[model samples]
Target: MPGFYYPIYFFQLDAIKHGVSVTFSFYSLVILNASNFVGRVTSGYIAVFVGVINLTIVATISCSVLNFGMIGLNSLVSVVVLGVFYGYLSGVYAALVAPLITTLTPDLSELGARMGITAFFVGGIGVLIGAPISGALLTSKYIWWIPAVFSGTISLTGGMVYIIMRSMFIRHQFKSQA
Candidate 1:
């Protein structure tokens, strides 16, 4: 989530360097935000049927793949397309994260504390390091792909962690029932 923000923040510069028009560059940002809005609204309603954790895992994985696709794209159209896809998927993942956390916590009374602690750790670390790492990659020139790869890998890893946690939770539930 925060990982994706780094590239988006630098998108204007990137688009200009790639010979994309100023109008389209700004449109790229607008398209991303608009699609993100749609994704957030739709995902919330969809989560009721599909489950928040499952939806989040799918969205994260999709965002990861889209981020990877961003690396090989040099055309304005390609970048815009990928940006819209990434925005939508990322929005879904972001919207569901809080609800997923709430579902995972065992005690309703401790939900706020759990959410606060989780947010502090994930947001604190991600916000602190994500931009710096992306900046470093951009400065390297030869290693520009590193930022996309790194962001995608992080998103993929997060999804895997969620999958594992979900499996463990299911196992525990079954054991208690048995």
Candidate 2:
């Protein structure tokens, strides 16, 4: 798929005649993989104190900015910058998953049960679908009507949902206290 898609996107810009096939590809993947590993390890160690929303908000914002910028990249330098930023951001994203769920449910034993049911059925689909659908979108330049547009839109929507739900929960908490 990268082989098929890279050429088209490569041709679209003057910086990469063949896109980032050789050195940059490996470098990009390494950066992303290393960051993901670090994020997960750190999240595992220090998740007791930080709120899940805060960590995930950082990840989502980073991704939103990078993904949006990736769409706008026109030069080799921009591509490299995009890769580094995206890798680090996605790394943070990997770190936030467990805390996000654990905090949402917040019962040690019960967290297991809740995450199991939700992760496999609901969250699994997002991971499954986000890529293929975005890949299908060959045109997202002007109107952002393709996969990238949809991905960013979903991220924004998720943020909105979090805010609304958090507000409702807070209101409930206040009323209960009252």
Candidate 3:
């Protein structure tokens, strides 16, 4: 998410910077965003059938894998690959947002709104910064590969966080049963 967002965002920004026409820029942004719509929605819905908490690990790993794939992309074909991968992953990611809140919080009533807030904050603040910052990384003598590094880092970080949290939850559950 954060990783893909950064590179795509930079791609968008770069296109605009070069006066690539609004249609071109908009289409690029649209393609980039389509990944989330597909990934987040589909995965999120599936999270509903399985335990949301359980799927958290799945979503996290998907994020990491997709992000790494995203990092390796060097052309339009890669973008399409990213869109497919990210879209599916994003679906899971979005689904887990609410489920995660429901599992952790006592009040299930506020789950939707609370999770929405969390998503907004995470997407807006965390991911929003990814592109521009990576773009900054690109400023230094055409170091295009820098974006891949940053995106890869973001994916790995998100995956680690999911793994740690899922493990803790599992341990807690096992202990309670014992």
**Best lDDT goes to which candidate?**
1
Error of 1 at 1 (Å): 4.6
Give one digit per residue, the lDDT tens place, for model 2 in 52-125: 67666666655665555555665566656665566555666666766677767735889888777776567777
* Global lDDT scores for all candidate models: 0.77, 0.56, 0.65
> Tens-digit lDDT track for model 3 on 1-178?
5674654456555554444565655666677677767666566557668778767767666666765564455555555566556666655666666667778765687877777777777656777777677778778565656766777778778778767887887888789799
**What ordering of candidates by TM-score runs from best to worst?**
1, 2, 3
User: What order do you get sorting by lDDT, best first?
Assistant: 1, 3, 2
TM-score winner among the candidates? 1
C-alpha RMSD of each candidate structure in angstroms: 1.7, 5.5, 4.2
lDDT of 1 by residue, 96-121 (tens): 87898888888899988888878667
TM-score of each: 0.91, 0.72, 0.70
Q: Which ten residues in a row have the lowest lDDT in candidate 1?
A: 1-10
**Candidate 3, overall lDDT?**
0.65
Model 2 lDDT vs. the true structure?
0.56
